[model samples]
Target: MRTPASQRALLVKISENVCYTELVYQRVNKKLSVDWSHSETEAWVQAILRDPDSLVEQRGKNYYVANQRRKSQLTVNSHNYRLITVNRLSK
Candidate 1:
């Protein structure tokens, strides 16, 4: 499990590859019924990256997941983030 602080840092490192459009942001908040901050969104993105198979499916360049898991705990799906690239940032 990743701490929120680490997740925030990771999000900053991958900010270039992440795309959360206006529509996507709105939809995510609507779905989750919470006004999520950028940190929250980043955390969700990290969770999704950790488990790509959990995604519902790829709709074009976007990946959708109805829910996410932290370890074995389930969480509500907030939004889909398009990963523009998959470079090895770390080993």
Candidate 2:
């Protein structure tokens, strides 16, 4: 079982991205919008949505999520979203 604070941390870590928070809020306002602050690093995520398909195991570290772009779509308009794609860049 996860404590309230721990759960909050996990949610914050996952949704550090703003657009993502807004997306969730739009869908359901139950619990997940209390700590979606605006981060500059995460801002780029919204501006440029990048989703990698693979994880880079370098020095025993999953570099995929580490270097992931935290972004999400807030627009409910289906016409605006043609397709969302993420490219994996590993070397």
TM-score of 2: 0.21
lDDT of 1 by residue, 1-91 (tens): 4555664444444333556556655655665566888668667656655553332333444433322333222222224335332211221
**Clash counts for the predictions, in order:** 0, 0
Candidate 1: misplaced stretches above 4 Å? 1-16, 52-56, 59-62, 66-91
Model 2 misses residue 47 by how many Å? 18
Give TM per candidate: 0.41, 0.21
lDDT of each: 0.45, 0.32
Model 2 bad stretches (over 4 Å): 17-91
Query: Tens digits of per-residue lDDT for model 2 on 31-65?
Result: 32334343532453333323332122212211122
RMSD of 2: 15.4
Where does candidate 1 have its weakest 10-residue lDDT segment?
82-91
